[model samples]
Target chain A: MLGLAAVPLIADVIDEPFYTVMFSRMLILSIGAISLNLILGFGGMVSFGHAVYMGIGSYVVGIGTFHAIEDGISWMGNGLIHLTIAVVFSALTALFIGSISLRTRGVYFIMITLAFAQMFYFIAVGNDNYGGDDGLSLYTRSKFYNILDLSNDNSLYYLNFTLLIVFLYFSHRLINSRFGILIRGAKSNEKRMENIGFPVYRYRLVAFVIAGVICGIAGVLSANQTDFVSPAVMHWTRSGDLIIMVVLGGMGTLFGPVIGAVAFLFLEEFLSGITEFWQIIFGPMLVLIAIFGNGGIDGILVRLDKWWQIKK
Target chain B: MNWILLLEQIMNGLQLGVLLFLLAAGLTLIFGIMDLINLAHGSLYMLGAYLAATFTNWTESFFVGLLLTLPACMVLGMLLEIIAIRNIYTRSHLDQVLATFGLILFFNEFVRLLWGPIGLDIQLPEILNGSVELIFGIRYPAFRLAIIAAGIIVAILLYLLVSHTKLGMLIRAGASNRQMISALGVNINLLYTIVFGLGAALAGLAGLMAAPIMTVEIGMGEEILILTLVVIVIGGVGSIRGAFLAALLVGFIDTVGRSFLPDILGFFVTNDVADTAAPAISSMLTYVLMALILAIRPQGLFPPKGV
Candidate 1:
């Protein structure tokens, strides 16, 4: 809450493109993290392959815009058509993968998802038409029917911010709904849910699809923000990064991933600026967090809230 | 296809399988005995390659380097188990995954910093450098044959140790039930550390053996690590026998697919398209095998009873 309230104030004081760009990037990444938390945190699906959704999303925008600029094929206004296609494609892919993967449990599921993602990563690297390992560039942002100019820094920032708000709202509502209760219950105890007459697999699969769709949206924004899409986006290591964000923020909390994404990126930017051996420091820090900080940043906030309520 | 080439590819597949078994043996043992998923197992392999390359450079003798580095890696393995891994036995898998994943990042970067990003060649000793003539005018690298010999020897030793000795019984017992082992007054912590150290040493040995044939470099562990995971998944989580068999199956399928899939596809599709699509399709072979295996038997081919 404090971070969201302070965003405009921070924007006002910074008044620079570089800071704005950084903030926008943080928003997009946070969206990705939050999307992952839906499945991993709430639905109890530890998919080590979530970054594929982002890759699919980014590639959709990249390919769509590339064709628009190169071949002059604008099927619809701006790039909304492409964004929708990306979301649907990502969701369908998730459906296929989840059906097979959800059949296994524990470490097997994790490894299978990881292997499938690596397959996708390699395919992206091998596709010569899509620039192969070099990646594709979007010379122009999505047209969006000229309702908004994505090239403008402020316009893009607001666009990302608005999407972030919408996503958070949807996530909030979904988690509070009856469907959310079933999913969370399944996460806590799948057998118990099954005993209670809920088809646990169906609920988890739905959650997985929802998470993939949300991630797809983030992917489109990411491509537009960076003006590039590459195989790197889908790398398993990137998926690991999203997992770190969710865990660091306090898994199962609505805003925990958001806080985690902010802190993680800021720490990366800050530490890398300080030294080339930033990962050495960051890596151990994450280990220490996993070992000691089980509750994450949000856990600390919850404690503070309790203390404040007592004081009042 | 010519029979000789086909036979050669089969041999190559077996050789690859033997190499994978060397890596998977330790990995599955660690997973089975300790209930720990050590992603950093790959880092140990990477370290072994690095250490072997560096030591060989220093000693100017591959034999001497291998002799010296074996104990050095074993000691490093024990040290790592004591310092970092011992504390995580009771933690959740999520925590284990994150912490180990962090270790991977740290180790990869540390290796790059220490050895530079470029790959190093670990030259084979002259004694094992040449190819040996086989029947039908076939020839195979002597070092790879040595690797196969070493893998079989280790597998036999592992089998004898696990099935025929006191330590092996304890390991089997531990895998079956950690709490029961503890109840029986076994020093479970020490046992876990030993198992982990052994696993690490095995991984290091595989790395050292692979170094001369493949370029020793950072992140080499990641690809092999995934293959090892597949082996464990197909073989069964806690069964060494499963790992050995699965490793061979996976290795043969992968090798044969990559080698023969193109020519086979050429008979159906145009040569140009077949050449391009074959490699991609071939790469999916292990994953397809894994999916099929899961579909048939979710617990894997040889999951330890009750696991």
Candidate 2:
């Protein structure tokens, strides 16, 4: 946290301010990845359309700003309204998508989610009022008047960083709570959980919504960072990328997604720099990981910790 | 309403259905027998197109190219099953999903490297390039007509192969009870490899058929892959018969809806609203169908055995 807090100052001193901007994206996606871990890692629901919530969050901001600029709908420009609408609307969307997607288990569930996300993506691509396939741009960041100003990059970065920390604390509490235990237990053996007098479906559904809401907030931040919203925001490949982050970091561990997100960005950045066909190498690595079977980068750290303790 | 135009559209839908069936048959069988989901099934479709394009360029015959593409696809399929897929059989569904997803990345990039970023084109044979006129002056592409005919032929062949042949009996036995079949001294591992190859060959055939109409390009698999996934899901996991019916239904809904939905919606709404909603709704139609079906019958329309 101290090192992250110092990023802006360090970037300015080193005259390489792009690091602050870049880290902002990684942190936001880390939040998204973490949200996914709630269901994917702990609750045993692999939602292939997790990023659709993020896209919905973004479009809320984009549509708000669109109306604000085009029709003098100033209240739509308020960050509070943006966040509230994003939250409520995303929760509702998640409910609808989850109800349908959760009906079938295993590969069927994955396909349904992928199919539904594709539906949303196509709708965004088709809506000409929101710039069609070109996407919508924010004329100005959502405002809080005297209370906050997102127009300042530093303030925005600080706000994102603060939110990330708050989310970290909240999720930590969430996973260890009784509710969290129920959700995780359901993942282990849903039939037993149901037989033990818990309504596993409802429990899973609630977790799904909570995860969607958090990921959606990350989407809002990402849109704010880019100042644009498009169907590309929730493309299946983007969702796949999020899943990769969660898996690569460590599924059932907190902070593993953060590690995964950072590692992913680094791998993408470094490998792309080496050659354009980086997927050839990166693709096989995932296969090897899946076949070998461990938690992820966090899993590696955990094993190392055990080894060190034994040595001592 | 123009019945002739509708008929032409129905033909288009049928051709698409045939293509989907080819892919879905293999997918259903693989799932039924091996209990595997190959997300890279679509990648095989893509490779088939690329292979057909190359072979056509060499042999100067599309039919010969297609013939050549099938065996090639089977070999590639078996190789993939042996190399990458063989390792992940007992892994979790998540592992299978991600690893196959990895295969997609590898196959997509591998294609890009070998074929270049530009897409390849498959030329239709001369006789098949012209239009076939039906009754009432309705006309359709002869290539598409050939596709439907070929699909029927293959479906018949597949039916005979699965219903009568010794291999077909073994496949049925494997699908019903893997342990019993293996206990009976059948080579279970070899059966899996052969099934995977069969699935790949079918997907490749679909790809080669699709190549003439659409560009033989990278990532084309993902789009059709989603559609085929929808088909198998709606059809139930293991039943080839279910896959067949579901593929035709989805293909018709997609094609007919895309072409006529605006007009249909315009009946009850303003033209502007219809125009705006048509594309979005058309694309969503199949997914919505799947959701609704699963809601009422989560086992899908024609599930054969316990999920």
- Against the true structure, whose DockQ is highest? 2
Candidate 2 residue-wise lDDT, A1-312, digit = tens? 689888888988998878888888888988999999999999889888898999999999999988988999999998888889999988998999998788779878888898889888888988888998999988888887778788877778888889989888888999999999999998889899999999888888899999999988888888898899999998888889999999999998989888999899989888888989999988998899899858999999999999999999
Weakest lDDT window of 10 consecutive positions for candidate 2 chain B = B298-307
What local lDDT score does residue A172 receive in model 1, on the 0 to 100 scale? 94
Off by over 4 Å in 2: none
| C-alpha lDDT of candidate 2 relative to the true structure | 0.90
DockQ measured for candidate 1 = 0.66
Residue A253's lDDT within candidate 2 is 90
List of clashing residue pairs for candidate 1: A78-A143, A78-A144, A78-A145, A79-A144
Q: What fraction of correct interface contacts does each candidate retain?
A: 0.50, 0.76
DockQ of candidates 1 onward, in order?
A: 0.66, 0.79
Badly placed stretches (over 4 Å) of model 1 are: A1-15, A76-78, A307-312
Tens digits of per-residue lDDT, candidate 1, A111-179, equal 888878877887787777788889998898877766889887668878888888888999999999999
Error of 2 at B121 (Å): 1.9
In model 2 chain A, which range of ten residues has the least summed lDDT? A145-154
